[model samples]
Target chain A: MMRRYLVGLILIGLAFALFPLLRQAGVAEAPGPLASAYLENSADDFGAANVVTAIVVSYRGFDTLGEVAVLFAATAGVGTLLTRRRLGKAVPPPGRQGGTEVLETASRLLAGLLIMFGAYIFIHGHLTPGGGFQGGVVVAVALLLGLLAKPDAQVSHRVMTTLESLSGAVYVGLGLLGIVLAGGFLDPRALPLGVVGQLFSAGSIPLIYSMIGLKVGAELSGIIDALKGDRS
Target chain B: MMLEIAIIVAGVLMVGIAIATILTRSLLVSVIMSGGVSLLASLVFLLMGAPDVAMTEAVIGSGLTTVVFLYALSRAKQPDDEDAAALASPPGDDTDGGQP
Candidate 1:
């Protein structure tokens, strides 16, 4: 207890000491160089009204690929760690008797809306605040709710793994197409840059983000399944 | 001024929750309180105008993590219960406090 208190106090003091430094950092009222550049060039170059989507899917596309790879590796690692042999007897299955009727009905009712919302978020990512990662997580939450409502319900491993691999392959293929047809890899300009502020205007950005959303959603659902030990 | 006060209050509440999480004996309670801390921190993030990050933190940190912790806790308790059952059953079988 004493050590914890001491550590807490030290952390508080460190935070206080850093506060002034943060304030003195001369926070910019406008976007930084990279942000400003993206903002200026997004419409002309990528035909995306949302500068953030342009940056994420085109300007810094390689970084996003790396992020996806990291997530994939983490999911694989968790799957290995929680293998049935390592876990011994399965952890007695959650909600063995099934959740209450109210829970089941509510989740069933909400699941479709949640999925639609997630789709909307990722589909309109190039024009909205959300993107692949955020929308993917929302989709995962919907699946999680289904799991909670019906523990015995099985999410087909084959389907999830297939979706994961297929999305990843398509994402890579899109990048290669960019190299062949456009300036460089993951170039949104590979396709026709339609009118700005339209759904299909961002060339391949929305497509790529949609693929990313599917890939992320599949990977996260796989991880949840592995953790839940629902090999059946 | 009102926003500043709100931020300060949230910060204080987060700190208090952190302390409470550390001090709590019940692992489940601690997990829940840590979720509370995430909730408060996300509020602060929203106040600071990072709605994206705030949403992520609230959903992933406070929501999913808490559920995961509870699942893990339930799994962990089983082994201890089995160990206790094994210990108790042997004593009853021995009938004389295992003096045989």
Candidate 2:
């Protein structure tokens, strides 16, 4: 009786909370002044046709740096918690042989395509709707798929750690280069801004975003590897 | 007009799925329903002209989160020494085994 009443109360409260948001649904509004300015100048200023990419990688990159740090910390925490030192060799592999034949075959075929798609997303991030984070997730998903397929394949922790460290260092180094050679930290203008829509046009935005993609991919793979537990 | 109706239907379905996710006693069902909620939300986002957000929600929210939860569930220990129950039950309940 108590539980039912509590649930009812919570539902009522949620309804009340969502009512105002519901009222605003389907109502279109013009962009605010800040948005208008960003839209107007981002292409010219950042040499990136995708304004969101400009903002994420250059206009407000410190916040992105912090977000990457947070992801790194989370990966580190998961690794520390689930590794062989902490958890003994009690839990065995759920699948003794591997994934089913169909799964293994399908993932084997899809993995290459998935990786290529992820690379394309991050590389074209400066000109398109997607960016490093989404691309990184796709890459991590590919790694996860491969793990699901093979189950006993050796994932080199050394390689993952090295890639993660190198990418993170490159991101920060580029930020420092921005401060030294351009307007501020992570300024896309650190290098020459070429034509707005070209591949090499965004002046290090693509480079920085690629680093971010690699870093995020490696970090997420580390977390997944940790969770896979004592496969060795 | 059609878009608005589609969005409304998606929103209502999300609410229904959310309720189902909470009300389910089985953890595996709950986790899957949670993923369903994300999948619906991604559709809603795509309708709302935010494909980037929709992709993120679909991949991370619906895809990776489900896999991670299943891993954690598989790692969790059972109460007593019927080790087969843990392995046999498929992480939630092969035969309604979230019981005392």
Candidate 3:
């Protein structure tokens, strides 16, 4: 009522005040200093056509590993919060009988293709717009579709957990390998940089991104399973 | 120019959706509208040339969050429905409940 209106008015006034200041700061027409350097040397440094990928999977690989750990922690937290012992027969709610036949058929038909596409995205991350996180989410979406189509179907928790653990371990191992073979930890130059703009050209960037993709996909699937709960 | 116009339109729509989400009484509707806001924001991000962020926003913000919210809403509603059913039943049914 009155308070809402006053708050809205204050927000509007603040926006108005900030608008001129924002306009006074000219929009960037060129890359900044750091970006310019990255752009200039990304090809030679990482052999990655996608500069963003080079920066994320090579230059800032440690930070990306931390991000993965954060996601793993969040997924674990969600599972812990949602854990409950099974009491009785797990009944499907009324009127949700595994979706319509078309949905079931479509999901079954599309799941494999979606997974392949996700793999492609992450594998070609050093040469394309998508990377591990994006591809991982796409993979999760594919799994989610399967879950929606078959409400009673269960993703194998043991397999997913194993994949998550293995991928995380491999990512760390690769980082350590970088230290042993190259300049420092997580350095992509540990492996020979292949031809530029090719799929296998970005040294260890593709491998690291692939591991990240698998780990993220497995973690998200685990979270989904935790949310679905054990009906057995 | 067309891209700028599209971005502006999406931005305005996002603002409207945000307001509607806040004002809506229904939790489900609010959840879905927030997803819509995420979607529009993703579009805005794409226009701004950040495909990576835009994709993340579209997938995680809109897709996963919506699914999680719906699951939570269903879980929250179940207890209320069970409580109502229990309340509707006769109090004398408590005699057999001690078997648990």
TM-score of model number 2: 0.86
> Which regions of candidate 2 fall more than 4 Å away from where they truly are?
A1-28, A93-95, A99-109, B77-100
How accurate locally is residue B99 in candidate 2, as Cα lDDT from 0 to 100? 26
**Candidate 3, residues A132-204: lDDT per residue as tens digits?**
9889988887888898788888787788889999999999999999999999999988899999988778789
Backbone Cα, N, C clashes tallied per candidate = 0, 0, 0
Chain A: TM-score in each candidate? 0.89, 0.89, 0.88
TM-score of each: 0.83, 0.86, 0.85
- Candidate 1, residues A31-111, lDDT tens digits: the string is 788778877888999898877778889989999999999999999998888765555544353446878899999998898
Q: Where in model 3 is the C-alpha error above 4 Å? A: A1-26, A86-91, A94-96, A99-105, B78-100
Least accurate 10 contiguous residues by lDDT in model 3 chain A: A84-93
True-vs-predicted CA distance for residue B3, candidate 2, Å:
2.0
User: Which pairs of residues clash in candidate 1, taking residues 3 or more apart in a chain or in different chains?
Assistant: none
- Residues A1-232, candidate 2, lDDT per residue (tens digit)? 9998999999999999999888977465887798899889998898999888888888889989999999999999998777564465434645578778899889978988888898899999988878788899889889888988887777888999999999999999999999999998898799999998999888989999999999998998888778776466
Docking class for candidate 2: acceptable
Worst 10 residues of 2 chain A by lDDT: A85-94
Model 3, B1-100: lDDT tens per residue? 8988999999999999999988876777788999999999999999989887888899899999899887765544433232244444332232333222
Ranking under TM-score, best-scoring first?
Answer: 2, 3, 1
Highest-scoring model, TM-score = 2
